[model samples]
Target: MNIDTIAKMLFFATVRIENHGAKSASVGTGFIMTASLENGDQCPMLVTNKHVLAGAQQLVAHFIPRKPEANVPDLGQAVAVDLPPTMYVGHPDPTVDIAVMPLAPTLLLLANKLFIQALPLSLLATELPDLYTDAIEEITFVGYPNGHRDPMNFTPIARRGITATPLQLDFGGKPMFLVDGSVFGGSSGSPVFLFNQGTYRSGPNVITAGSRIALVGIIAQTMLRNAQLPVAEEVAATAHVKFAQELNIGIAFNAKAIKESIELMVSSAGQHLATAATGDGVTELSPA
Candidate 1:
């Protein structure tokens, strides 16, 4: 896709996710990813943080409908798909907060009813170009903050920040990095990207005049700091603690973790496909 199309497509790449529990409801973000299979099949999957769906009795994904004539989103014509919790498959490693859900079945049901622009797996940055340690690239993350989004347009809020830590090294001995931005509760599962158009530096003293984009990571946690509590004039026996203040730094799991999570889902589906092909106690399986 051209740079302008790609940039515009990024706006539709994410869906505002609402987690509904028996007693309460919460919100977060989720993005669609198109994973290519070895069998020449393309599977669309919804990617998000595991915690976003935790304790969710029903998950609702808000999607924009397509205008048949224009083949573009119909803005105000938004549709929501309420799904059971069983549809989500989380990372095998409990520590890995990534979760993925196959979108083929859902799309098949919705059929030409919705307009979704999925981010291709090619956008995942598995490796970085040669760069020195001093390089600090600009990053952009798309999501809803504080459960806020354009209710009429169904568009997410895009925020920009810089890498607070080196992408080459795992931050805090984990497969994650830090970003300096205004991250909030509902921003979890936001896809962090590196998008440079027109011109970019390929190496030291080298400027390349081309467009570049990559899915660098996914937001998981926001850093916080406890503030000192003030003493009461009455000097009560105990004082209630206030909520921690946001440090405006976000913790994002790197692209490799996302690739691994998608692979896990794909491999599981592939195994089922192989079994079905053999006609050996195999049942019809949907993409995982």
Candidate 2:
């Protein structure tokens, strides 16, 4: 597919995620991905940031009603599906901040009514030649900023930007990179895409890279600068300072991390399945 077509397809994989705490409610963005095994097995997973799910007693995923494509041109209502604890599978390392949840049950419920798509495992950097990540290119992400959606299509907003930092290099001592894009609270889990639009440089060599779309990383957090400089305790104790604005510097964990986490998920899923096959009522899935 062409770049535009591929972008539209990726949206089907991106969905609105809601994390409901016992007393408060919050929302974030996430996307879907598919992993294929050597044994000819394919697994569907839902991914998002770990912090987005923090303190959440319950989780709900919202999908745009597309498959049942509205008969009229006007916009329609969205479907909100509550997710059980057993439905989500998070990364073993709490520090990783990436979670994977099975999407089969969700797809079954939707009955193919939602026009969502899953990202192929081939789009992962770890699964591809190192040349892709070695090249610096433009990137984009779709997400709900401040819990806002299109309302018309019930889709998240698409934000485009370039890589402020190199993909293969670590940012601030972490396995992530800096993105020169505006990031908000609701964008915590947005997947960072590295889809080329035209010719770009590949390290010291130049190449005509076009229509190449791969998920290089996922937005983890954003950088913030103190709008009001902090004063010494002796000068102004308990001083109230002005709020800070988004630096538009986003932190995206390398997609390699996701690939590593997926391995853990595959193994755990096998064990979970074995237990389920025995009707043991044992499920080893939970949010980190």
Candidate 3:
């Protein structure tokens, strides 16, 4: 399989999150990003939805081991690192579904054995130039949907769709937008991107023939349809609910929310680096 440079990078950028709780086991998606500090230091963080990390007895992050001689992932050989509970940090606002966990200690353990692609904050589309001319733009997102991935290669799957809501405006008066894509239960925290190659719109009547890529947002929730029941006085006492139908639409928190979440984590008494051994003997970092 010949993967392009962009696809390969995106594949490596994502890490599978397995949440094992007392009742059941669930899966979700997360991507690596470099959070910049005021002191000019860059820290690699695992960005994902807060709900994905909630109620988990233990969290394991799956990563692809790198083949040093070939400078590529070993594919079949994967590594699982247990993440400590203290490592999780959520957005200051309880309502925000975004959270970030530091990866410095995890990277140290991986060392040269695993390959990771961390995107910098500069990629966040604080301002989408193309949005000025077009309200509906195509987007690409990478993740493990419904916990499905390459069984042999251990890589993330990429999906494409268009923006259902304008990127500049907050959807439903929140810092979010909608994507018309086949988002599933395990796609939370997937990074959304706006990728264009060849000719793209630059202005109202100007077209630029070049490539552009921007990190527009991150997947937070998938819209689902609940069947409406007939109103009855006894409905509240003996209500039986059916499974919600997938709407094929995903709600994503825009880049501004992501930035704000990072800032909130950083500003809270500064990020302290504390090293501790997990139950499985995996090294984890706890930020203050």
Candidate 4:
């Protein structure tokens, strides 16, 4: 599909999860990865940020449409499917902020056999022309923000931005842009895309040499603070009233960290495929 189309697809798979008694939370994005075993067992895996799924053994992901017409209904109205119990945790890598969860047989079936407009693996691997050259690149970021509830009813919004720099952040360090585009709390794990020619591929939107849309960073934090005035003089005088200032911020794991996690997961998966090919009854690998 085209770059614009791919951006929309990535947004649909992005979700928000509140953890730590709602005191802490994160926005995580997922993409489709289809795995084929030599023994003929083909499955689709959901790849996402590892910290997004951390702490919660059992989790739920909301799926929205890539494009929802103004006349359409909310995404929550869309059928909600429970993911199977198969969890594929990868050894957390300091360099990348990624992880993989193997789809349950049932979920895999739904993606491969039922979902109408799934993201294609081939499209993800498509190459762009001189993405890291002098060409100015435009990209779209998709994800559910704090206020967006349903996809069918509530229209998903796409934020437009350009690549200001290349992917040159220190591995395991914070990676991001100085885009005029605004993103909020729920947009943490949203995938950043770089438009190249007419197609889009996995990577940071690159604007210079050594820089490419390299799955480089995630929305980790947003700066926010609450202002409070001292209790009214009369009230303060009558009773001891205390006021405190608080700050709220957003932070995301660097995409390189995530990429490392995925590589580990893929390696483990490759082993499983090898075992399956050898007729070993679906042997699973330990988290790498």
Candidate 5:
């Protein structure tokens, strides 16, 4: 598959986790990465923003596949699915916004059963060229907004945007690309990709060129302007009417931080796999 196709697959893995009981909501996106199992065998792992899964006792991921043939029924329905029992969360580093979830054979099988294709783990280490080298780089962001339900309405919407700055900046110490596109509260964990300029298969598999997409960074936070008041009542008591301006904001993340998190997860997962391989009769599976 080409970059666009791969991007869609990445979006499918992105999920919206809700915790009404906890009175909080967050957005998270994940992609398959390679890791080792207890038997010292390598397996696929899921990686996403740490904040997305923070403090949740339960989690569910919704995946939407490329639409079926024109004759197929339910052409645009969103598909709701769950990760497998073998999935395990890696130690989270709050400093950086990332987390790794190890996937067991059962999870891979479950993904296969659901017809959700996992992106090649090799892409994690592939170096993305600096967007600064070019005046503009075409990109796309994918994620679930507002804990929305699934076929998330005919596959995740691919929003097109261009990098606005020649040089990228660190967002809270994570790699980030400044784009002209507007993202909202629920877009925190969206994966931003550089469009690949290449060919693709025809039909429902139509792959557009000049659209090579690379996982450059994950959406973390958007910059906003707010009045600094000692208290809400202070501004109100000063004889000023309550009003605020909503301006176009900026999104940021530390590129190096994200890279480090991914590397740590990959490295730690390998060790876990080796430990599992010893087979002392200890189950590595985390209870769902």
Candidate 6:
């Protein structure tokens, strides 16, 4: 399909995470990992940058009701699912900025009340053959910038960008990649995907006609440059300043790190299997 069609699918997987701190509240983007169990079941878990929920006394996920024939999702009855900090499981590595929180038993019922679409763990960018990576030229990232969203349905903003550095090479000694895009505040934890449709050239004389899509990584942070000139604020006021300007470069943590982190949690005691009845008297399936 087109970008709009792909966006619709991606939007379902994206959620706005509202964090409540002691003195202030912040908003960021997060996507759900629909972990499938071998027993024909799925686990709904929230994944976001660890720093997004850092010092968060409370976490809530804002969801929009998605309809079949709407340009934007329906927001008439938006649902805010409450997430407890106690339920969160962080990556084993203290340095990795990824964390996950399972859906509470009570909130799990909302899955039926509204359309719940989550990103399947299978889409996690696994060990793709080098040939596929060689064919990839661009990727897309979806999220809210500066905490801005579609006023109608809270749809996350989608941005298209190209890889700024070598895929295999580590950026700043981390297993991450740099994206040349206008990523800003509130975009952290956004999912970066590589999608190719129509005709594509795999090699010098190799042409392909199928579509390809995969979740390659998630937004980590924006790169910056130390400005030679003082910022406007610094020039206006007489004070010592060391401010760096946005270099327009964005960082994406490799999906491998995320996969390892979540697996570590699930393999540990973080994975829970439970069932709860929905408002319609239907039971929902969850990871155990």
Ranking by lDDT: 1, 3, 6, 2, 5, 4
Query: Each model's TM-score?
Result: 0.86, 0.81, 0.84, 0.57, 0.63, 0.82
lDDT of 3 by residue, 51-105 (tens): 8889888999899987878556788878998887467678777877899887777
Q: How much is 228 displaced in model 6, in angstroms?
A: 3.7
Judge candidate 2 against the unseen true structure and give its global Cα lDDT, from 0 to 1. 0.70
* Stronger candidate by TM-score (1 vs 2): 1
lDDT of 6 by residue, 1-288 (tens): 222444457766788888899999988888877775544566677888998888889988888754556433455557787777556777777877888776636346665564555666666666344334552368888888888887866677888988887666677788788898988989998988876667555556777775556777889789888755544774568444567789888988887887776776666754533322212111121211
Model 4 Cα shift for residue 7 (angstroms): 5.8
Distance from true location, Cα of 17 in model 5, Å:
3.5
Error of 5 at 1 (Å): 14
Residue 18 displacement in candidate 3 (angstroms): 0.2
Best candidate, TM-score-wise?
A: 1
Q: Cα lDDT for residue 65, model 5?
A: 39
Please write out the lDDT profile of model 4 over residues 242-277, one tens digit for every residue: 443323323444444544454466567664332212
In angstroms, how far off is 243's CA in candidate 4?
Answer: 12
Judged by lDDT against the true structure, how good is candidate 5?
Answer: 0.49
Say which prediction, candidate 2 or candidate 4, comes out ahead on TM-score: 2
Cα lDDT, model 4, residue 13: 42
List runs of model 2 lying over 4 Å from the truth.
1-4, 68-75, 133-136, 229-242, 271-288
Task: Kindly report which residue stretches of model 3 are placed more than 4 angstroms away from their true locations once superposed.
Answer: 1-4, 127-133, 228-243, 269-288
Candidate 5 positional error at 139, Å: 2.1
Number of the candidate with higher lDDT, 1 or 3: 1
Instruction: Order the candidate numbers by TM-score, best to worst.
Output: 1, 3, 6, 2, 5, 4
- Residue-wise C-alpha lDDT for candidate 5, range 224-271, written one tens digit per residue: 566544446754676444344334443634344455665566566455
Q: Top model by lDDT, which number?
A: 1
- Per-residue alpha-carbon lDDT of candidate 2 for residues 143-231, written as tens digits (9 for 90 to 100): 88888887766767888998888987877676788899888889888888766656544446656654466677888888887687566
Give the number of colliding residue pairs in candidate 3.
0
